[model samples]
Target: MKGVYDIGGIGLTWDLAVQGGRVPPVEFSVDPRVRHSFWALVVGGGSMYMGYVFDQSAIQRICALPTVRQAKLTYALTTVVTSISFVTLSFLGLVAYSYYTVRGCDPFKAGYLKNRNQLVPYFVMEIFHGFPGMSGLFLATIFSAALSSVSSVINGLAANTIEDLLRPAFDRYNTTEKGKIFIAKISVFFFGGLCVSLSFVARTLPGTVVQAAIGFVGACAGPVFGIFLLGASTPWGNIAGAASGLVVSLVLNAWITLGGIMYGRRPVPLPPAPGNFCHVQEVANITGLYLPDPFNNSTGYIDFSTSSPIPVAGIDSGGNPLYNISYMNYALTGWLIAFLVGLAVSLATKHWHEPTRDERLLLPFVRRFWRLNQADELQQAVKLRHSGEHSVEGPQTQKRLISFGNQTSDMI
Candidate 1:
């Protein structure tokens, strides 16, 4: 079960269970048996989220094109490149796991994973395999994954900060282009630096690297995702409904992370050693689905003896349950709550109306395409240029004025 827990990306939870006397001691290593399991979770989850971001961004950009041909080309190129990258990364990760497994080495083993503390030494050993060889390719793949993630976040955040935060402030002050760019660059630098700093802080937490990273991102992004879904899908959703959803999602995520800290639940104790492992037996039985591979067998039964205990409840004053919920389940729950609340409030308020022109412009792709088509239709009805026989503004303008005067005369 310990082996299964690690493979399922729940190594930290299992470790906590062990520390809380919830499970037995077991060897957790990067055995070939488990490497595939661990890497599958990492690559699959990461790529899915990354693909979503790229798709949304690409759609927006494509919509902003002035012509159908431009949109088609842009969409095709963006989709193909992003899809290829995601597929390639998944293949490389699988290959890496297979190679390690065939060699009787476990890259996903507790000690063999390339984390910050061991990354330098790991790379140093790989150098003996030739600087431009398989090792180099492996390192390049890792860098590509990291760069893709960082670039996506930086670009998304920069765009949001500019459009939502900075642009509005500048509109009041009538700031220039250079000033806006300066603010944007500063926003990128600050957000990047803050993330790096927080990552360092995350290292000090008592969880597997994957879990820690997910917890961090999920906690921050859960609310944002809720708001986005609400705003994009619901016409009746007002700012108040969106804000409410955001707050609820954030609070729920925090409650799960801090172990009901807001409700006065005591913190769960950390494991004694860095590589300590655990497993939650109840989780496997809860759904009767065996928690999936490489945690359980084809029959959905896990060997619990090889796993450690995971904490299920925070210590309370009377040893009562502070919150009987799993952190893993919070993501889905938060999303559902936000969506329902936003939808209900929006419909109840009956505030449906046409979106403002500026709001339509915010969807740059749609606005550009629509406006371009409108321009083409108007051009055909009007002369290419003013004729000397007509006013400088052109015959079309004079005709419209004359028509308006005739309408007034008829009204009189």
Candidate 2:
């Protein structure tokens, strides 16, 4: 069992969690100038993108339910489960922190902490070390959960490849059943390999797997969410405006994300070590000592008590605000940028003046806002025919009809 972790004498509390248990309530930040609002934006945006909008699998699963009521019930259940899981994870992290602090074995000092992500797995190993067959079972469970995600990714990629790349490049590839199947297999294999290769790269990332993945997705989430928000909520969301907003948002997000990663980067200052974790040396005891790969940096014990935290970035070469903003804000930045730009573009664009009348294209939840599917004549087209203007298949009825719809537009 992990002992209670404390800095100096105070014990670690769930309220304070892993923030090093400072007396004055230390605020963890990469930069002092970063306000609570900025943190909130990123946290909200990242969470929204990862858990909802960007998670097509989750959306699909919810939609696949037999009834709307059932789907809503499932969503509620999922939310409750997710909240419990988060609490459980937080506890695990605290337990690990306590164990390390009490043992005087700073993970950073013990070696093999390329990124702090390894902490969770390392903690799991220590806790379940002596349990027979339990480790395998736990691993199996983890893999099984991960596999569901993997399947969704592969399916989405394969569909995208066929629709966007393969079918477009070679006509009739998707038209025939045999050709479609072949393309799907090829797409699955290609994307599967790509994802596998990326996993190796993920090992070297500076943050946790979830963080890195979320950051990447967050870069685009803003634009996506912006588009959906506009489409569902606003009558002025034309395709041209939406597309323009997305493009601009993409450029803006890319510039910030890449700049932060490559040039304007600054390592986050870790909290001062608890007790003699840094100054004094300690070793972990286990059947087989946990050894990191040779490429990992060897443990360097730093005297945090004496050394000051690394300074945050001041200004960029272009004299803009330091792009060292946390990746957490990626989605928020993108969404706001896209929404503003899209709104501006929509006001200027011609399409916004005359929006699409196709109610079928609108989301079911938002469909209530759209009064009619088409113009009054087109709207009454179906009703006119149904009242016996002409037979269902007659030339007169077919000629008057521009297209078929349940909502509106029986006439051209």
TM-scores, all models, native as reference: 0.49, 0.70
Error of 2 at 18 (Å): 6.7
Global Cα RMSD, each model: 14.9, 8.4
Q: What is the lDDT of candidate 1?
A: 0.50
Candidate 1 to native Cα RMSD, angstroms: 14.9
lDDT of each residue in 2-76, candidate 2, tens digit only: 223222222433433334542224345545234223454446444454436445556667667899799878777
lDDT tens per residue, model 1, 203-295: 666545555565455555555556666665544567777777778777866776565323333334422221212132224445564433332
Instruction: Give the top-scoring candidate (lDDT).
Output: 2
Please give the CA lDDT of all the candidate structures: 0.50, 0.62
Which one is best on TM-score?
2
Worst lDDT window (10 residues) for model 1? 270-279
Worst lDDT run of 10 residues, candidate 2, spans 1-10
Candidate 1 — number of clashing residue pairs? 15
